[model samples]
Each structure stands twice: as C-alpha cells, then as structure tokens.
Target: MKFVRTNKDRLVLISVAGEIAPARMRSPYSVTTEGKVKVIPVLGGITYNVRVGDSAYGWEGDHVEPGVSVMARKKEEEIPFMTLPCIGNEVIVMSGDAKGSRGVVTGKHGGVNHVIVHFDDEVLEKLMVGDKVLIKAWGQGMKLLDHPDVKVMNIDPDLFEKIGIVEKDGKLHVPVVAKVPAHLMGSGIGASSSASTDYDIMALDPREVGVEDLRLGDIVAIMDHDNSYGVGKYRKGMISIGIVVHSACVSAGHGPGVVVIMTGEESVLVPEVVERSNISDYLR
Candidate 1:
C-alpha cells in the first residue's frame, strides 16, 4: 500500500520474561449467567483443545485463554511483562521441556493481567507451569504516515504489513471479521491504556450480533470506540480494530476480550469484512 512511516529508525525494542501460569479459579464454583453455579477450567496453563483459529464460543470454560497464558514471576515485574510485549511479537521458551521452542504473542487480557501466546499443539504438550519464556517486544510506536488519522498500537511491524491495510482516498481500509457496536463493549472500559490490558465485548446473546462465530485472533471492528491518546473511550464517529484474545465468558461483564491494534475516525478507518481476518492467516 506504500504507507509512509513517521520515524522508522526510532522504534525501540524491549525484552521481558514471564512464566507459564498455572490454571486458577477464584473459588470452587463460579456463577453462570443462567443462574447456575459450576466449576469449569478457566485461565492459565497450556490449553490443548482451543487455539488461535478456533471458535471462541460454545466452551464449557469461562474466560478461557487460548494456547499458553503467561505472567511475570514476581509482582514487581508484572508491569513490564504485560505492557512491553505487543501482539504478534516473537516469544521463545527459555526453560522446561519446551525450551528453544518459538511462538507468537496473540494478545493480552485485563483484570487477571495475563499475556496469551499461540504455539503448536506439540509445543503446548511440552509446556508446564513455571516454565520461562522470553519475549522480543517491538511494536509500540508505529504510526501510518499516509493515514496519520488512523492510530496503530500493540502490533508488530511484520504482522502490520500483513494486515492487508489498503489506502485509497487518504483513508485506511482495514480488514475485519465483524463490526461490533459500542454498546456491546462491557468490561475494561476506563483503562488508562490499551497497550497492556484489553477490553471485553458483552455477548448477552451471541447470535444477536455477528460475533457468534468469532475465533481467537480474529480482527474485528469496534464502532464509536476511540483508543487515541491512550484511554479507551467512546467518541462519535470513531472506530477501532482489535484481535479477540480470549474465549467468550459466562460472566455478565466479560466476553471475548479484544486488544486494540488500530483506531481512527470512522470515515478514515474503514472496515472491509472478508472471509479471513484472523492473524493466523497472516502467519503459520
């Protein structure tokens, strides 16, 4: 698309470490929206069944993190681990049986503050809790020179190039799986930044909108939601594109969370719904 770069040489690289977190549940039972209490596998560990291109719905689990969920070893290092690694960054296993294995940063989740990584099923089988992984974080300060109005964040440069963003009439046309209404946005509303944690899409009725068939890593468009200048807020005529990082939730305020990759004026940030909008299509 020949999009211009603001300052290609100035983008700094960050390195951080975190371990595979063990699967955890707040209590023995979690309340479902249907007024039933049950125990289900939630966040953390290596998920064998679910993956990047798999459907986010129809799981017995609640707020499940696909693939491997990682977090810093200590509380002090949590901020850097969560904030530095942007979506699509490279991750290398540094400890345990999976050492030397490679993966890609899928996205991050809020509240629990975990980063999700996608690896082959073979690698997932070898991964275990307390295993360490190093991340090569390099996608924080990118901006589109030709379409400056369209803000970009939390995405690696290589993946950005593969996003299929086309420029015409001075506007950026981004590919998305579906267009999500502003009202459907439920959790993580007033966050200070979109670089670290993610916001959720409330799916009270999954079939009510087109998100029923959404999959992890699918890029979707959020209407009237602005992430320009850090805060995730609602502004008239604004739109944001994000990746579904986690599974659909049974919790009232949570659902498949989306980490923003790009945002701008609706007029300039056009969404082109296509058959393929998942990041897995861009990579292996």
Candidate 2:
C-alpha cells in the first residue's frame, strides 16, 4: 500500500517535558468488575513488565497503563504536557539511569493527566518514577487538504502517514482493529477538551462486538462519535479514531482507554477493521 501524505511541513512542533509520575491508587480498595472492591495497580509511574501488544484484561489492576507515565511538575506545566504532545512524537529521557534513551508517546490519560510512553525493554528497566523526559511535540494543528471535516489531534504526522489510510470514493478509509459504537464509550466522554484525555470503551465482556480482540496500542474507530468540539458527543453519522492506551477496567462504565487522534463526519471518514491495526504492528 502507498503511504498517505499530508501537509506535515505546515505543522508547527513544540517542546514539552516532564518526569515519570509515581503510581497512585486513590484508595486502599477500589471498584472492580460488578462493584467488587480490591487493591491493585491503577496509573502513573514506570511499568517494568507490560508493553504494547499485551492483553488488556485479567490483571489484578484496573485501568492499567502500559510503559512509563510522565507528567509536568506544576498545574501550569501539566497543561502543556497533557495537551501538546501527540501520539508517535519522540520522547527523550533527560535524567536518571535511562538518560538519553529514546521513546515514543503512546497515550494520554485524562483523570490522571499522565502521558504514556513506550521505550525499549532495556530503557524500561532503567527508568525510575522521578526520571525526567522531553517530548518533541507536534501534530496538534494538522490538516488534511483533501478532507476538511476530518480533524487531526494528538498524533504525530509521521505516524499518521504510516497508518493504512486510503482515500476512496470521496471518503477516507481508515484501517482499524475495531469499530466501537458510541453507546459503549464511558469515562472521559465529557472532558473539557478531547486533546488532553482519552475516552474509555465500556467492555465488561472481552467478547464484546468489534473490539473483541482489543489490545494496547491498537488503533480503533468509534462510530457516531464527534470530537471536533469539546470532549465530543454522540452525533449520528460521525466517526472518531484513536489508539488503545490503557488496560481494561473492572469498574462500571470503564474499560480500555482510547486517546483521540482523528475525528470527522462519517460522510467523509470511514473505518475498516484490519488484522494489523496496532502501533506495535505498524511500527514493525
């Protein structure tokens, strides 16, 4: 397949940096599947074992985030850290044992306000909770000339080009691992802005619909979804595309989280499920 080209040169890239956040569990015991309460891992900090392409369920933890989690020091700085960088942007370890190691931004969790990054297994072993990292943030204000309604957000221009997207019959056909309906969307739906946080897919049962085999780093599409405005709404004939950033949650109205990368009207944007729709597969 031919690569999808866009006005990448016209996009202005920014610089954002932060430190690895500490793992936090709001309460000693938290909600699980069917309101069951238990103690487990949630978000923030560096995860030594889990990486992309891993399962999203059957973990002792709820809403488990893969890879290293980063966030700015103060509220003022956190805003840029959460919103500026796009998925696929370059991440550099600026401090600690993993100093100078390179990585890529994968997802942004809203409530926790942590940016997820994937590094090599060696780098993960070296990364610490307080280690600092910098992001070469880009792809915030990107435009697809051929399709104006399609709004591109937190996704690197280079990564977008690599996605198996083809313009067909006056519509943009996007290759995705799953096609999630709007009703299944749960937490982070009404966020102040869609650029910062990720929306969740309420998949209590792993065998649910199109997202049956959903895994971390997999690109999926949401039907009847519109993120062009605020956090977005459920409007008929709309489609939003995003990446599965975190693990499945046992909590009610919570599951694997997906960060929006692109969205537009269904008339011009189309999602097609394919076997190789994960970043792990695409990067390879």
Candidate 3:
C-alpha cells in the first residue's frame, strides 16, 4: 500500500522496523489472521500518535530525525529565537517563544529531518510537544549528489535537499560536488549527535575537517572502502549516503553518527555530498 501525504509534506526520517524486509529477514514477522499469519509494514517505523494501544514504543537509544517536531524540556530559559543546530547536539532554547526549552537530541531522521532535538519538562510547558522547526544550514563542503555514475544504499529525504538535487528529465541529476574518499570516513558510522563535543576525528582530510566546512543540515556520503553495500569488490566506487547527524567528535570507536540515507523510488544508488546553503546560519 502507498502512504498518503501531500507531496510537499513528505517525510525524511523513518524509524527502524522490528520485522525485516524480504531481503533483510531470515525469518519475517507475522501474526495469525483468521488462520494465516500476516506481515505488517509499519510506516516510518513509528506511529505519529503515541497511545497505550500504539504498536510502537520509545527506546532510549532511538534518536529523533531532523526537521521533526519537538517541545522544550522546560519553561525556565529565555530563547529570543527558535534554535536549530548547525551540527547535531543537545540544545536548550535560550530565548524566543521556545525560551527555556530543552531537549535531548534524537538525531536527524529524514531528509527534512535535518535536526531532531528532543524536549523535556521546562520546555514542554511553554511549547507544544511536536512543532515543526526551521533550521539554519551553513558551513562548507555541503552539496548534492546526482548522476547515475554512483551507487547509494538506504537513504531518506533530507539528504536529497542538502545535496541540492532536483528531479528532472526522468532521472536524478546529481551534481559533481565534493567527495570524501571512502578510506577517510571513520570506521564507526553511527555514534554521536553532538560531534562538536561527543567525538573527534582521529584522522581527516585537514582540508575537509573543521566547523566552518561541516555544519548542520549538510548531506554527506561515507566512502565505503570495503564496499559494505556490495556495490562491488574493493573498488573505489560504492558510496553510502547519510546526513551528518552531528559534528566531529571523539566518541569511542565512533566519530559523527549519520542518519543513514535512503531512496524512495527504484533500487538505484546515488553518491551523497557536502555543500553550503543555509542563509540563516543557525539563527532559524
């Protein structure tokens, strides 16, 4: 069955499913319906409305996808503006309508889910629990990936916008943006949302490593040196796309975690890249 939503309101972040897809499942999940067991496809791996009867449950380890709604942790702080992180990290809305708002960051979950920040008590009192937020994306090396020349495995929508790609001509036109050799990507792909504080790069292209170059809302591809996606043998070709979940950090065996990218149509893989476009510079 197809999902129903306005084309403009399409989702980028999706939660994980307990039952694997046909390809991922050694044994798929099913329930007895009448006499036959049936498989269920939980959309976005989550239920938008939380209820006791809901099939989904919250997990401490699960993170929020960027661009999703979040409320303030409390109502004490004073935020003059609605804040969005350029890099994923814990934040407290210091001022504005959401002032005194605080939330643990669930990392960005969808293409539009560029910065997922969770909220707590104080912030919740002053703000609604789920409010669509505006983010300011800045920094360098952020761009779009287009062209049939590469392979992309598992992706969401937010990364698509970050790369600056627009669908046309019955094919995706990924621009020639900057690329980080698969060898340079850290071994642990998922780890920290606050790269600025949680982890650090043991090694990075001195040219590409820096806060100015990597900022919030930037789409990037992790070079798959081992061809983990099986695009082929150790060829310098396969690239796994993901949005930077946070800034560079020094997490154990992990640097910056990425909200893995995915494609909505056709089983085609496209390379991801980094580019700069946020005019607000985190002010939004």
Q: What lDDT does model 3 reach?
A: 0.32
Put down candidate 1 lDDT per residue, 156-185, tens digits, no spaces: 888888878877777788889899999899
Where does candidate 3 have its weakest 10-residue lDDT segment? 16-25
Question: TM-score for each prediction?
Answer: 0.96, 0.95, 0.36
State the displacement of the C-alpha of residue 81, model 1, in Å, after optimal TM-score superposition.
1.3
TM-score of 1: 0.96
Models ranked on TM-score: 1, 2, 3
Better candidate number, 1 or 2, judged by lDDT = 1
Candidate models: Cα lDDT each:
0.86, 0.85, 0.32
Model 3, 1-284: lDDT tens per residue? 11211122432322211110011111244332134443443112222222111111121112212222332223321121112232323345544467544443334322112234434334444543333333232211222234333333322223334444545444443432234454445434333321211111223333454323543334444444332322212335444444444333222232333533322222234443435432112221
Model 1 steric clash pairs: none
Please list the residue runs of candidate 1 whose C-alpha ends up more than 4 Å from where it truly belongs after superposition.
1-8
Model 1 worst lDDT run, 10 consecutive residues = 1-10
Cα lDDT tens digits for candidate 2, 77-107: 8888888899899999999888999999888
Off by over 4 Å in 2: 1-5
